[model samples]
Target: MQYSDKYLAFMGRAPKKIPHWEHWSNPDAETYLTGIDYYEHPRLCRLKLSQLYPQLELPIPEKDDPKPRPKLDLKGQSSNVDEHGGHHVRWGDTETTQWDWGKHFKDAEDVFAFSPLAQGDFTDIPVVESRDYSDEEKLYQEYRKMYPKEWGDKAPKGSTASVSFYNTMFMWPLLTFGWELFLETCLDPRFERIMTEFAEINRRVFRVFSRLPVNFVICHDDIVTSRGPTCSPKWMHKYIFPCYEEFWSIVKAAGKEVIFMSDGNMDAYVNDIMACGARGIISEPYTDYKKIARRYKDCFLAGEGDNRILYRSNPDEIRAMVESMVETSRITGGYMMCIGNHIPWNIPPKAVKYYLDISAELAHR
Candidate 1:
């Protein structure tokens, strides 16, 4: 049986031709590449893109897809101006709708009084589930329904079964109370109980994950800004890292590897995250990929490629960027070609094509 490049890369085998796990979103670039209007022919545009860049995993819609609706009824209040009827168009599409940010809480006192376990339905929160995970078996059954019938409890050989949690330890408070309230109350002694409650909620979450048919779990938490850590090392060690160790240990014991994902520079906490039992990290371009490569030795790593280099539309810079990424891949077998900052709507189409072209030519061991 031939193993997939993704599975091989995840397992650190270093396939001859390195694979791509890009975070792409530039519909205008897609239209420019395929000459198909993305709004009119979304599926065809993606299919053509996938054909042009065979390494990319672009999803093809079954039919003409409509604009995505907000998951929660925010009742018209949103931190994003776009969600409040403000049109911010770039590259032929309006800004995507955003979820309500801290609309539930009136103040720090309200945030302090909130109990995550008591308010079990997180449907209103961005990127989390609506169901109550109070019962582990019930949560497991619900989560198990997400996988295919042929798989049972084990993932098919050469194929990966995976689940991603958006509100990992740091995000629970961030999403629940928004940035201001969380920061205001995080230093207070009262915040300890709040974090403990959030941990209990995640204990249910990770316990459910342990029993699922997944080979890996992508735990996402933007613990750091583009500069560095949002909270100090001391604070992170106190609340976040400990929970990461505890929750990840659950899935790790059940044979599932953890891939920790965060936005911004992870230079400060890469070692800490690794120590917490993550098999790898896939973070943004601000992170030092070479540092992680040198230290970890074939552990999975990506987000070295930067979209700023692509956006500049300079062929030499793009080529150099791809070359640097390939050099990192040489050091670590699990490296993937990814433009970590994202290829958003406004990035130049020609530049994206040039980046892809260079990557195809040189992203090989």
Candidate 2:
């Protein structure tokens, strides 16, 4: 089958090709496609597609029917926003309050001194505060009022939205606290309580946001190392799985899909992750996609391209990577391809363009 037909069928849409590429780079449109504005750089998309399909034209269709807008069922989820303004931290800077817990520990001796034992009591740590329901409810009401313009005329139609709680534990804790202290906390009961408290906060947030119109929630919490998971699967099942299950159950009860995004090699805990109620996983290319696709054919799969190749490799290499990823992920069903992570700032803009362009072409082939 043609790529467009396959994608439409996969999405449960009629097998007619849609003019999706023309609006691929629009933030509003792309968010509908990938669940985030992570890659709304139109120039990048344009350049990438031009390189991948040099002979193919990407003209905006003339006299075409106005395409229906995408709608999602965010019944028990919330939008993760940086209401504080500014992009969330991206490396560097030592004293930012939002530094990952690990990073905080690395920089602040005081935090290390205050580090709690893995099994230590956290009953006194104060239950994490919840968002004001009135405020959130008002926001939702306003959002619903504006949903028509924001989402056009489409209603929930088998579309999904990716919603993550926050950055991964690996990235967030290490950055918020010093690595040593963060590690200590991971092992200590007191630290576990703090983590649990934060998880509660996430739960409350999820409750508020899920009331919106979305269908899938992608919770991100990386626990893997380059070689394998940093902690034992048992440890994750003990400390993290409960939180995931709680939130995932909420999402699933509201009839939305749940997925997780992690980094590094996670070959050992795929079963555990699946048991946590997630339908798919996203990560950098450290894990084996072939194994994952074969093992979890019922779940969705996203990510797995090498960022270094997009930044430094030639066009041929980029094309090869795209083809391999698309083929590998196109296993039984439920796959979407993207950069292993955010595109590096140093990668030539043209290289980024070439990568995305090829992906679009392949998706429509």
Cα-based lDDT for every prediction: 0.84, 0.54
Q: How much lDDT does candidate 2 score?
A: 0.54
TM-score of each: 0.91, 0.61
| Candidate maximizing lDDT | 1
Best by TM-score: 1
Candidate 1: lDDT over CA atoms? 0.84
**Model 2 ranges off by over 4 Å:** 1-155, 167-178
Residue 200 in candidate 2, Cα distance off native in Å: 2.8
lDDT of 1 by residue, 246-311 (tens): 999999999898999999999999999999999899999999999998999789998888888888
User: Taking the tens digit of each residue's C-alpha lDDT, what string does model 2 give over 1-365?
Assistant: 33443234334233322112111222232223333332334444444444544333343233323333222112222222267652332211111234333322343345535423331333333212212323445544643463444554332555543344544233434444545666666666555555654555455556754665666565776687768877776677777777777777876787767777777777787777778787777676777777888876545565677777877859999999888876765563656565655454435556656776677677532
Error of 2 at 327 (Å): 1.8
Q: What is the C-alpha RMSD of each candidate to the true structure, in Å?
A: 4.2, 11.7
